[model samples]
Target chain A: MSAPEASVAVRQRRGSFGRLFVSELQLVFGRRRNQVGLVVLLGLVTMLGVALKVSQLRHPGARGGDIISAVAGNGIFLGFAGLTIEIALFLPLAVSVLAGDAIAGEANLGTLRYLLTSPVSRVRLLAVKACALGVGSLVGALVVALGGVLVGTALFGAGPLITLSGSRIGIGDGLLRLLLAVLYVTVGLAALGMIGLFVSTLTEQPIAATVATAMVSTLLWILDAVPQLDWLHPWLLVDRWSAFIDLLRDPIFTDRMVTGLWVDLAYGVVFFGAAWLRFRNKNITS
Target chain B: MTATRGAAGRRTLWLVAAGALAAAGITGLMARGAVADPTLPPLTPAELLAKVAAADVDGMSATFEQRSDLGLPTLPTSSLPDGEDLSSAIALLTGNHTVRVWVAAPDKAKVALVDGSTESAAIRNGNEVWLWSSEKQQAKHATLDPSAKPTPTATPMSPSEAITKFLDEIEPTTEVTTSGSGYVAGRAVYQLVLTPKDDASLVAQVRVSVDAQTFVPLGARVIADDGTDAISVAATSVDFTRPSDDVFAFAPPPGVEVTEMTKDSAPSGTEKPKGDAKEPTVHGTGWTAVAISPASTEKPDKELTTILESLPEVSGSWGHGRLLSTALVTAVVTDDGRVAIGAVTPERIYAALAER
Candidate 1:
């Protein structure tokens, strides 16, 4: 009876969830570094678009016997590869920049104490921050993908989206591919988000959290690429994330894809579970 | 015991996780196991060929459409005008039909590419003898029999040699299915969709129309990864009569610029358009001809203004993509290795005039 009443009382005290999310959004995107990542992402996608345009113009003969051209003319090859090349091995880094710094940046600014001093429970704060970060990541991924597609279509013509694999997918299929790529990449980066969030909780400076997350994620990727250590392939975070290519194949293969998504989700769970356990009972005087 | 327990716990968690992921994936494949493993009873090479050879061939004509992801060919796709050789051959076998292949010789022939598609290819390799046009360049040579295996000199791996190779993969991926039925090229064609059991493959489905009685596949549609229908090739005309051996041979006419494909040829089109070639290129009119389409839209979209301005000074030839695709289709369909402009449409004539 006492537990129920305490829970009801705590829930009532936090005010509306809407007000909380609004504040969280402001805190996440309302920073200079987020703007920097955004600018970098835009510039990168723009470069990819320009490159595709110039290459097509410069080398017409180079197209024959080229599978990319055949598929592109029939309207299938542009969007999938263009997006992947523009920002893979690079996505996790951007994610780390924003998420890795979330909590640590707050703690460093000495504003963390304000939250602890308020009636906010540790779990509520972690939940709100994660949700906000997820939204931000979603926005970032969509912007890059949309920018790539828009530019690719404008310059290359809105042909069908061809795959590296030997299949010619149409235009509608291209949009679906774009959505899948964005969603999977965003989910694949969730572990980084949690790692960044956790590191943020421990450190005062956001840069430390950001760097730590990028270092760990990238190191795991490098480890995954080492073929000799065959046994370690499945365990590392990067191993599971490699399924991003599956989305581009002609007939969608969901078996490996779904499995990868779940593994990513598991990583997020473990990270959040650890964060919850660590910060739930800790004191914050900073 | 306590240390052992901790290790065991970790091991169990790992085991369970791995097992769960694998099982989930396999289960999905099993649940969505709509594609039949058609090759349940695989046939040997000889049986597949005899079945195809004796199939009926007459005035059956189809608007054969062959699409390659790249202008170049890959895998079994390397040999067929599109991805039909396998399905057509399979239909010939179990569906009760036969299709004949008349291999072309490289020498004693003068063939040229009539169309100008950047990536797709169409080559008149041997006069009316043997025609070679590929979406891509793959090494293709001919073999004496289906089971004889391709030798380095006569491998049928190139797009021109696709007709033979297409029949080869068919016996492996096909099963006698009593599914959809249809007619193609004036032959009683039975449409059997071959379901390749490899779940990871991009070929989601293949819809082939085989002569219902003859079992010769007259038409087929190759669906790509994006669920878009990429290629639709149909047999426009099939002549079962044996052609002269000289059909495959090619010899350039007198005073012709026979560029002995140098060790270092300038890079072709970047999916290259023929008009933009850095080196001297081939022109279409010299070899054989009639405007197949006369309609320009079927051809490559080159900057004619640039070519026109450079006219008399331009190094290479010009053609359209549609013409390339058509020349390729005609070569495969007629099998005489000799495809001249059989028919001409008015739209194509206008397009041709503009290009000229």
Candidate 2:
């Protein structure tokens, strides 16, 4: 082919990849299951906000101005409290549902083969799927947080946030911290999403992939809970799930949060790399 | 096609190998950083125990910080009236507190907890004891009876007193060993580890750091069976010189509210129950000692009930109750309104209750 035609082909390829990325995002988010997961998460955050408001009202004279009670006085803190309650299990489960289904669900439905037959490179295809899963996980986290903010503001109203360190922060700064907390939690869940994506690539059964991903997350949580397993704490994926608590501190402790980010980054690289290598070479029989 | 697949498999294998190597290296680095001095001379279990038992320091004052991460469920504090200070144990376990303790031997000692801007102090000077809270601007005066035994104060335990209590409870069921050496407050110390032999006990080990030269316990940590530090106390700074007598003497400021407790009067504002009714009845001895007591008259509040409901229930010949088990402590409140708390297991607690 001539040089001009080759350049045109390259432009067409880049354009097609962009289209694929957008289409992949829509496909993942358009799923009923993923939507239901977000709704359920929102429901949980609402329940938590209501419970906290009721508890605060019932006991007006609670001692100590700790962060948990700070939520009762200010709606902005509800986002932090909601994230704290859900990061343990529900958030991961929601992310897993999307991530675990990203690849395996396509294969289960027998559409993976058709997708592979397209002019798309296998690497680009996997990258798009991973990005879509990452976006899905972030949205899942935001749904809970935004839901918390709305419900909390309706019940408790917004005010200056009283930090765990006993310092008060204005509503604007408190919301900024809340945003950082949400991003931090999303990054952690995205790492788990990569693990789920890797697990999904190994099996044709979407349910099995989801279950495997959740089992892995649960195992990490169990390891974190065991004090005798201190050797494994630094390496466990969920070990720093609570590190977001540091964001609520007065000076904002970023040491643990930074370490958690690094841990999540490492997990994402290794697991996603493994998934790519495996999927790149696997025979697409489906 | 076959050769291409073979190459792909080889690449995947190498990728996994590299990942494992990186993980192991990181873990190794972390493990190395956690230990202090690993090459110290090893003391035999018997020698270590003897050293600990003989450990004593006099006329010393230390400023210490304590942190407790027991992972305990929150309990309601509604039973405690407003303006009443938290019990020392609760305050110590709940948050960070800087405590200055002065021990001048025989009967003179003082402990002051410094809050951000306020200070609460308990001073025992000869027969006169004074409790002062700057936040409340109140002071309580109690005169000790010369004939009656000295009553234990509700103040947080001094590091020396805590070490003495731990040493007194040593039994054959304890597996004692020297963990190695470390520095506490810039002083070289030997770490002595004591592990309970009881399988049901949540206490994995109790580590006591002894000052190598003075044999003073500079630090002590209670490690639960799960490996988490349930309670840790360390002297951040120490001065061997005796604090002046003025440190132990207290005269309330003119504007502060003063409540004087005579010998017959009940202890004012102190959460501890007065008289023998509050004393826990010890059952068994050593590592398996279970302290049984009548349940508190204060009802469990909403929050405490929720926490109790979350705990697993255990039933035995002694009756049914919920058990709160941590790494080093197990507490059981039975259906009969009796409470048994110990470092032993729920079964052991039940067994002790049955013996009663």
Off by over 4 Å in 2: A1-18, A51-69, A119-121, A219-235, B1-14, B34-356
Residue clash pairs of candidate 2 = A227-B226, A228-B226, B224-B327
* Stretch of 10 with least lDDT, candidate 2 chain B: B76-85
Over the stretch B1-356, how does candidate 1's per-residue lDDT look in tens digits?
A: 88966865675566456556655654453243233333223333343334455565432212232333312112232333323545434222221111223323322222222111111112233222222333333322222233544456554354324535555555454432335444444345445565544333344566766554454666777665456554565553444443454333433322222333322342221133333323322213311123322222232224423322332321112322222222111111111111123112223232333344
Lowest summed lDDT window (length 10), candidate 2 chain A: A61-70
What are the clash counts of all predictions, listed in order? 95, 3
Which lDDT tens digits does candidate 1 get at residues A90-196? 66777877775567776777787786665665667878878877887777777777766676666666764444323346778778877887788778777668777
**What is every candidate's C-alpha DockQ against the true complex, given to 2 decimals?**
0.06, 0.05
- Give the alpha carbon lDDT tens digit for every residue of A14-41 in model 2: 8988998998888887888877888899
Query: What TM-score should be assigned to candidate 2?
Result: 0.55
lDDT of 2 by residue, B1-356 (tens): 88977986786788777777756655653343244554556776556656666666668888676767776654444443332345544655654556778889768998876544345678889888888765565678888877886677687786556655655566467877787688777677788888888777777888988777777788898888777888888877777887777667576744356899775665654445444367779987777788998756666666556767888888888888888876567899876667899987777888888886
Deviation in Å, model 1, residue A115 alpha carbon = 1.9
Q: How much is the lDDT of residue B60 in candidate 2?
A: 88
